[model samples]
Target: MRHSLRFKVALVFSALTIVLLVAQALGVKTFAEAQEEKLITALIRDDIANVMQGYRANPALLPPFDARLNGYVSAADQPLAALPGSIRNLSEGTHEIVLDDREIHVAVVPFEARRLYRVYNFSVYEKQFRHVIDMLMAGTGIFALLTIWLAYGLSGLLVRQVAGLARQVKALRLGGSTPINPGKYDEVELVGLVEAFNDYHRRMADMIEREKEFTCNVSHELRTPLTTIKTSCELLEQDAAQGTKSRARIQQIERAADNMRELVNALLLLAREESTQNVEPVRLARMIETALAPFADRLANKGVETVIDMDRNVHVAANRSALAIVLSNLADNASRHTDRGHLRFSYADGWLRIEDTGSGISAHALPHVFDRFYQASPEQTAGHGVGIGLAIVKKICDRYGWPVELESEPGRGTRVSLRLPAAGPGSASPDALSAVS
Candidate 1:
């Protein structure tokens, strides 16, 4: 009967009503019983208390009164059974009496003439209890309606906030031009979540734009030298008859061939760096030692000091070919730029730091440092280094989802750090860090 809220709430009101109704009923019953008892007591004291005196004064009238009020007045052999009291004293059962032509309740107690009578009646009290129950029912209905109104109001605010976030997500684009704009919220958690999502979406969009521009430039820049080499080769083949002219043609072809070769080689290295992404666990320390072996004679010739602090069992997962190409480019760039300095490489805690103590990249040149065909100002240029190494390093790092951070000050030294993921984050390739380091 009291399981659900509807039942529970209804029951709660019903129970309260029952308590109040019962109390009212009890109070009225107690009052009615006292009134009934008083009436009976008074009737008995006034009429029956002086029955003997009344009979002596008007002995003839007593016979008529007995005949009128007594239940046992057969008019024959009924004098011995005549009782002194109201008709309510006739029996001990439910009884009805007429009061102004309407029914009322009365219970009579038979007792000695000197003792008082007891009477109890309940009909009058029942009416008051019914009104109390009805009042409670009406109040309970109003309270439930109010609760539902309150719940609806609160749910509206919650639903609106959720709808705003949903619309933002639906409108999200990886490379969209429009930026996200999440407004203020009543709740802090919703605000924080919106901010985080907006930031992530913005970063991804920027990265996509960067890649698109990179692809466009690579195609335009590499195509020019390729076309030139092809044209030069075709002309040389068509004019083989003239000896003097042929010699000059051959010289032109050689220069064109070299330029074309550089373009092709650069493109090939970039492709390799992008395609190779897996690096299993390996002794990168040993690999670094090996990489240094080939550079030793060149370092000594340039009077460059080398310091390496690598873990004894240094292991990192990455595309080894790409990593080695990155290292080699940094090293070669270092050697070419430095007038007199040192280089240090360290691999620890899943990071590889390569510091080159050379004249740092100029502030003006920094923005275009990774730009193709970009070089330091010719007057300040330190060597005949083609300005593509840093760009290549950046592309490779991007393909592998690694980050390369650069720190430099003009005339000071430069530091570059590479972040490597542990082997188990994704798939593993061969033991390639050994080759890469």
Candidate 2:
């Protein structure tokens, strides 16, 4: 568990306050006790001096008596057993003793022929001091609670701006022209950070604009030639005098042109960071067959059987062109890698899976297989194109919020799974359904 900055700051402040309060309380207690001791000593010494003087002047005069103080004078040669047991062995000095479970301060003094003992009972004073200590502890407890509350509030105030900035950053959208308003913040550091983020966003938007223009220009320039090639091939196919091999070669060229056109469309879609709104229901089985049509001859030549296990009633909602590109690329890649095994396509539990029993990917190369222009090895590169097929598939899947996963083991083959968007209500077409079925 990680603590928030606000919580940490509050905790530090509370700890410091508690420490200072405890230290101050202890200091006050120590000073009060020391002063009380000094007062007791002064009073005892003054009384002892007066008693000695009064006794020397008139030997018959007795010492003053009170509830807290008592004076006792005895012969200097009296036996220790003659005095109270608690103070019997007292020397000529003041001492504190527990007598009858009560605290007593005793002062012993020796005159020429007599010994004097002054006893002060301080148990009442001790009870009063204890009451003061209890009050101090209560005050400390109340003060600690108030300090913690104040610290928490102060910490929240300190981090309020930062928390607001985080929310603004989170809400920011890609390609949005609006920038965070640095003017809203009073702190110089926060303002600087907001300004830096605005600059970065502006640069990114400009780059995206440039990319859009480039793709648009490339689409126009490249498609014109592809359109011409396809038209020329169509015209040649209609010519009765053209040889069978010539027509076949023209058909191959036409297919290549169509594939290139789809690639360009897929790339342009990936370049733009926007969702397509032209989504409609598409039957999965028929779409899969159409996507694999181009690879049929190749798979047949390699003796690689193609199997598609999807329900005819199953449908998905997606941009037709984008989904077509994704399916075609996956089918093409699977067919290219397999030599003589089977390529299977199945849809179940919201996932469209493609499995191939082919020359499986190595552990090292599997991770990088989806990377653009990444080739596993030279030997695998002969028929397996310049590795952008899966990369394009990945990009298309990402654009549509589809989750695509790939798994492979050396000498065991590869499998890919893609999650598709569920179709909306009443999306199936009666004519299309019958045709595919």
Candidate 3:
């Protein structure tokens, strides 16, 4: 599993806090232990000194003593009896002794006349040390929790700027028109990155604008010559001998000119960075027939029949010119490959589908057919094209927010569909029911 940057930062902060808290607790415990040991040693020595001095001044006064302290004295003939075994061999210094299943802190002082010993219960001081340790642990734990909370909060604050920047970048991808506003950022790297992105975005938009202008100029320039050629072909057809081969060739020239004109118009439509779609109710059946008119002769020459199955009352909201180009290209492509079998067009449930029993695309190539300039293997069939027709269809559909789908199988057939918005009541006319082929 991958962890987010914010989560990793918080974890690191918590770990560092815990380590510092533990170190602090240990230091406090060590200092407390050292101080307690020093005080215990001083208490043992002071108690023994007082007892020895009091015994010299008056032995009776030393008979009674505090419960926490005990002492023993020895003369030259009388050695201290019943003293703990640990104290018997003890040197003239403080020592811890275990007696009667209890620990004792004792200080032994050697004197010329007698040996004096002062003793204390070690468990009493041990209990105090335990209390101090408990307090240290409790304090450290509470502080550690607070430190973690603080670290988490600080990390959130630190990541907010980055999160905001990421959101802006996402907005740009989703067709946001406004330029990115590189606001103030405390981090140097973030500031630099924002600046770089802004610069890159500006250059990219400029390049696209230049490309569109170039395409528009080229298409616009070529259309004039295409129009002249189409006019010349029309005049020649009228004067040529009827049923002559020259007349057929003249028709072919006219068809080529018409195709070029449609291509130019489609290119211009695609070149526009943004377009205002003039939505109106369009007669779907009539539109299909009008688009197929240009390719009818070609379909007849190929011995392929065309079929249209639709309701004349079916109307859709669309841009007429763009829709015409889309349908024309689709019909032309279907007719080109289909040498024998009929091409079918069906409309229902706001969708128009074109199915062709033609040279179907290979499985691998099918997915990429809509990409610009992508062509299948020539050996597959003569229908292998220049590869811009379907791409232009896709571009127009995307502009209008229409959903387009294509499906094909090798040696079987291909189906292309378009889902459009339905028009309201009384939108279609009776004349929309004409046959396209």
Candidate 4:
């Protein structure tokens, strides 16, 4: 219905044209043929009978375009292009002759020795078709107009249900739960499809509302414990500075508590990202730097060197905070898993690769490496809080339509690569980065 009026009109006209034109052609042919057959039958039995008998008695040669003995009749405008001349030149009993490259059907019933009656039909159908053609040409335009009008009216009536469905779709787009109330007593299949679409929209609205409520309550409850832990750790840091050589142990405890708080924050951030209500552009390289800032001490403690290689202004489509969580998880996984080996971080060919020199993954565990609760090999599990790191990484890859591949051997080391998918030339999307946490 929203489509242009011209298109609908043109479609209707085209269908009408086919039907009307075919009927016109067939009617012209049938009428013209019947008229020719009637004339031929009459000539053979009635009008030319006496002329033929008179000519048959006088046996003579048939001449070209002979109208007298050969019953050569035609319309007034153009006489039949038959043989021309009289039939008095040569002796003839029964003669066969060609006229305008066509064999004329003829018979000579003898009435005398010198004169023979002859009858011939030289393509009578062709001469009659000319009149039919003229009539059809004169009337086709008027009939075509009538056809379009009648067809358009019927087409409009037939398409009324389609127009109603279009309006229902428009309403659903503007208002998620709007009903598609197109009438459907005769259009059973179309009605079923519209009903299914409305049902899907209703389910989606319910899901989004439920997720919003769950996210708010979970985030609120999580914040309380996080605040308590941060306060107690700050108090402990102040106490250790007062004159306790236990500064090192207290500092270690503070760091661990801070890490736990960051973990809780990451979880909440992940939930918000899944809501997909808000998104913004973020540069992946900068997020990597921010996440690296917190792990400086861990890198030093393990005697593992960290290298960052990337374009200074590389950009990716994402939420800054969500992407930060993603990098934090990946870096933490690399660092914690490596005992005293080098960790390499680099971005190349629209991909980020992280490799750690530590205990290479065991063959049996590689298959489930990214499972939600899978643990790393013993060397990296010192205090691995939860087993969701790689799982989160995998989810992020799926969301962005990226691919994450891991390569490892028993003693060589482990390498994780995140490569861009074949989307049009662009950086990652928000939902993809959000899946990281």
Candidate 5:
């Protein structure tokens, strides 16, 4: 279904060549036929003129006769009964008639009291002409075939450099510093294109190196403080005389630290082009609970109900940390948007789905919901967290080869689904519905 440039070029050349060659052959055939007719007419006219001059000078002279040419004299009032039946009724100045399968040219001229008929038989010449035309047609056909072959070869030569360039581009790597050698190309335009591509490749390599360094530095600086905060919270939680409120605050701090750590890890994972994490079987129910832990108070404060509709024994084969990050982001988005009603999490047939009855995304914003840093309308921007949560989920899903889909409608609700690589042996049943309010 896909056509390459070489094939298109060759087809165009072949078509044009055939059209021009056919046109030239037809023109030559037509011109040759016209010239032959003119020569025959001139010879007949000359013979008639000589016979008329001789008869005028001496009334007793007879018209000439030959194998190809003949002259007949008949009185203007007399019927041409002695002449051939095919040319007897002709009254024109010059006419062509066929007699017994032979072609004849007749020129009728009026003299003092008689009509002169100059009849020339050119059937042999006509046969020869037909043979020449047949030969010409055969030559044209052979030349057309040769032209098609030549056109294909020339087109291949024309596209050879471009094909080589494409191969070189495909072989290029992202982190490579070596450039395509411009000297390999002969055309100035091709050399310029090669130079431009080389420049772009170098710029991209430098940009990627800078981004890698930045992510490394930021990761180190942020994790150090996050670790200190988590350790201090653990130390404080161990105090014997700490009040209930104080203990709750310490736990909140610990949870926040944990969330920040997961966010950092997720961002780092997204920054790299490849993942090195080992795949393992992750308990689906436990991972969902962990992702929703931080949003428990928020959902409760909003008077929103929570429903988990998946079998407890269900597990998925994936990178644990990556799955955690994806689930956390989905939970965060659902919790942030839902003010009332219920948020549901369910898994079936290797698909994990999160549905929320909240202020759903509008039709205009739905398409761009997964774009990095894409904010919704002004009213929805509050507490949306710069719109990278879904972007992170999308990136992680792509990295793990999981298919993710989102559906939303304004004033209705939103649903996000992710198809995991593999699911454990289990099924959803009525007993699996666990409601928490």
Candidate 6:
């Protein structure tokens, strides 16, 4: 049922050869039979004419009987009474008769004074015909075998060419080689396939390089304005009136600016593909507080409760800027979705879980939650985002070999989990860094 291209080609080729050979055999047999009949008819007619002339010349004399030619003469009292029924009508043409197991050709000649029957044995011709048929059958068998061998060899060569192309395509996919030369193959479609794949690879590489350059440039240019805003907020917080709530608001603005600076740094490192392994032990609680700082006012304005369940002494080995970006993105996503119920961040069993009570993802959209620019529902995400937050988190985690998982149910909630590696000698203690409190 799963036949290969080569097998199908060979089968069709061999079948056509067989049909031609069979036709040739039938034509040869028919021609031989026709020519043999003509030769026998001529010989019988000439023999009948000679016998009639001889008997007429000498009525008392009978022509000599021979093996190849035989005849019988009836006496006056029994005039050809014992003659075969096939020649009883006394016709003047060649006719065939069978006697015992031998076939005979009879030429009946009626003269004025006497009647003559000329017989010629035709069994020898039949034997020759059988011999020729046997030879034709043997020749056809040889040619059929030759046709099979030739078809198989040609098909094998074609299959080898296709397989070589497939191997080259595989090498290209694994980033093991450059484009293969399509000119080596004579098939037009295969040449097109090679050329098309090579073109696509070149275009993809160029596009990614351009995107990386843009990200690096943008992150670098935006840092100056972000720094100025941080400095302005800090100044505003210090010189504000003592009893006013504007002081606390300015403090919040400073924390948000700090978070933005960390995010820009992380993005720059990502564009350069730098390893963020400058491992430092930061207190889990303090890290969470700093990450949630920018979203604090939003949560309060939305009346969304915040629940933090993490140990103060639980420290992890990570780069501060990169970890802050990852945490901020996750926490910001939770805050944006949840309105009334609490947004929870819990750390246990080396896993960090962020759960939000909001319109959860549909079953159809859940699998593609981390795909770039994928939205669960157009109506839900219309004014929310361009769907890049989770995609960014997934990309950062993949770069560091971290595992991330998501669970969601429609109309219920969504929960995201990040699995971190356990602390080791490479990690520092929480006491080494000042807490954010």
Q: Any residue pairs clashing in model 1, and if so which?
A: 279-318
**Model 5, 1-437: lDDT tens per residue?**
98888889988998898898889889999999999989988887787778778878997775533222133543222232345644545675988876556666668877654556765667777899989998998998999999889888998999899999988887786334568899999999999999999999889888988999999999999999999999999999998889999999899889889888988877787787547575666678888998999999999999999999998767688777688899998999899889999999999988988999999988888889999988766466675688888888888888888899999987788999899856445633222344311
TM per prediction: 0.37, 0.75, 0.60, 0.58, 0.81, 0.51
Candidate 4: worst 10 consecutive residues by lDDT? 70-79
Residue-by-residue lDDT tens digits, candidate 2, 232-301: 9999999999999998888878877887787777677667654676677888887788788788889999
Query: lDDT of all the models against the reference?
Result: 0.61, 0.81, 0.77, 0.65, 0.81, 0.77
Give the residue spans of candidate 4 off by over 4 A.
Answer: 1-24, 27-42, 45-125, 134-157, 175-200, 241-286, 289-304, 310-318, 332-341, 347-391, 394-437
Clash pairs for candidate 5: none
Instruction: Write the residue-wise lDDT of candidate 1 on 289-360 in tens digits.
Output: 655654566788889888788765556676565666666677766666666788888876778888877888
Alpha-carbon error at 47 in model 4, in Å? 5.4
After superposition of all CA atoms, the RMSD between model 4 and the true structure is: 8.6
The better-scoring model by TM-score among 5 and 6 is: 5
Highest-TM-score candidate: 5
Task: State model 2's lDDT.
Answer: 0.81
Off by over 4 Å in 1: 1-277, 377-383, 424-437
What is candidate 3's lDDT per residue for 194-232, written digit by digit as tens? Answer: 999988888888898899879878976998899899999
User: What range of 10 consecutive residues in model 2 has the weakest lDDT sum?
Assistant: 74-83
Score candidate 3 by lDDT.
0.77
RMSD of each: 17.5, 5.8, 8.5, 8.6, 6.0, 10.0
Of the pair 1 and 3, which is ahead by lDDT? Answer: 3
Report the lDDT tens digits of candidate 4 across residue range 1-437: 38655458757676769677868777877887688657655665554465554435652423333335443222222444644455434343334456677545444443333334354654555555677676776577667777777867777776777677777778777864656663653688777887787788788778878987987887678767767776776787777355565666565566555555556555665655553433455556656766776677888988998877776555655534445556788788777767787988787786788888977788899999889988855445856656887887777656545578899987778888877422234556454576665
Error of 4 at 37 (Å): 4.4
